[model samples]
Target: MRKALTLIGTGLAAALALTACGGSDSTPSADATLDPANPTTITVGATPVPQGRILEFVDENLAKDAGIDLDIKEFTDYQTPNIALSDGSLDANYFQHLAFFDQQVADKGYDFEHGEGIHIEPYAGFSSKHQSVDDIPEGATVAVTNDPGNQPRALKMLEAEGLLAGIEDDSAALTLTDEQNPKGLKFEENQPEILVQLIDDPKVDLAIINGNFILDAGLNTDDAVIVESAENNPYANFLAWKAGDDNPAIAKLEELLHSPDVKKFIEETWPNGDVFPAF
Candidate 1:
């Protein structure tokens, strides 16, 4: 009877152990249905010009193909998109060039990196009062961007027009001293975005405008008296993300962005040659 009681106790213990195991198994864990390979949504930040519109197109088409949803957050200012991306509020951002990205990373000490090149929107010289590039008189006040990156870009544009000649061809560090203006052209340096407002001023003869700012100002690229060539500009746009996110989604995005469909879309949408595909 002692042996039988011992055996019965053992059996009861085993049954209880099985019951506990079953209970633990039946209660679903939080990650039970989660699949990292197939995320449901991807949120990206961008500006409201062509970049945002292009991303919206990519989201609608590419997300559907990949069986994922894309949510795009549009920001007006340059700083907020990177902030959102770093804080995990956005999966990626689509509106900055590699140079600007490098500047941001260096300046803010952020751990972000850029992915594949997207598109190139050439900076151009526009004038509301002057009908042609040659019409500007001597001592005309030309407006340029005061920001470091854009300032050089504006100077380069002036150099390209034969208005300035002292800068070396390959010098990325070229400055205002490059200007060898024969016509005694006066330059006014201000923020690029604000240069558009100067068009209403009679003193400001012409302004060198960045592509994004030009689009933001509701001005047409064809209306620009002088435009940059799209053939070999190195400052094309790119996708930016955290430094270590070697996720498959980023690869997928790059593949789609470089595909022929996007190229065709850009060509057709920007027939005036304002925005050109980098891929």
Candidate 2:
């Protein structure tokens, strides 16, 4: 279930090619021309952990000098930020990966443009009942994300661990194949936020969680039995806004996100390899 959201630091508040052309009243309008002398405030929505923290860093260190003021709204659930962005509650958002973003675009017809990749959160599977992947027994219950964009990733990770097989990593509609259940593992799906709690569930033997949720849950990456490799990973999260938005401040913020200082911050903050700079 998507949690009720509140905006941090401020009050809370499209899809498909032809859908882009068919504009909705909820769609954010293109940023109007700004006066060169005044600072512009660009409201962006993001998740609480790294996305919000990274934006806080930019708001403190770089935004002022760049003639921008960032009003960041932190979201706990994945669906709300994009909804906020679509409904003009936020000027932009930075919570979703490319696959998730594409899924949103295709499903909802959001006409949004995104910046280059900023950071990668390596997905991992954690088990409190077992010491290692090999320790997981047959018919063990595993918890994975219910979101279409991320479920396949969890399936792929399980496949890599030899728990399951016959998975198409790129398929959004992917699901467990009973015949391919080499270990006879039972799978359960939950919201990404709920997966962390499932990690502690006595009935759940393994919980595959998104990195940001792991961080938010105060879980350590080193404890994960299996982690996704960051090499050439396409799930890096980036800045996104309504399409045709030519806000100069948005461009500036995107530039700062990929800057050396931001890179250093990400490396030092998450030195444990949970988060990697995707530049």
> Cα lDDT of all candidates, in order?
0.67, 0.79
lDDT of 2: 0.79
Q: What is candidate 2's lDDT per residue for 1-279, written digit by digit as tens?
A: 112246432223123122453222122222434443577888988898888889988888877777778888878888878777877788888988877888777776778888888999999989889999879999999888878878887787777778777788564322445766777787888878889988879999989999899899888889898898887788999999888776778877788899999999999999988899999
True-vs-predicted CA distance for residue 44, candidate 1, Å? 1.2
Write the residue-wise lDDT of candidate 1 on 11-39 in tens digits.
Answer: 23223211110000011112223243565
Give each model a TM-score.
0.78, 0.87
Among the numbered candidates, top lDDT falls to 2
| Shift of residue 4 alpha carbon in model 2, Å | 14
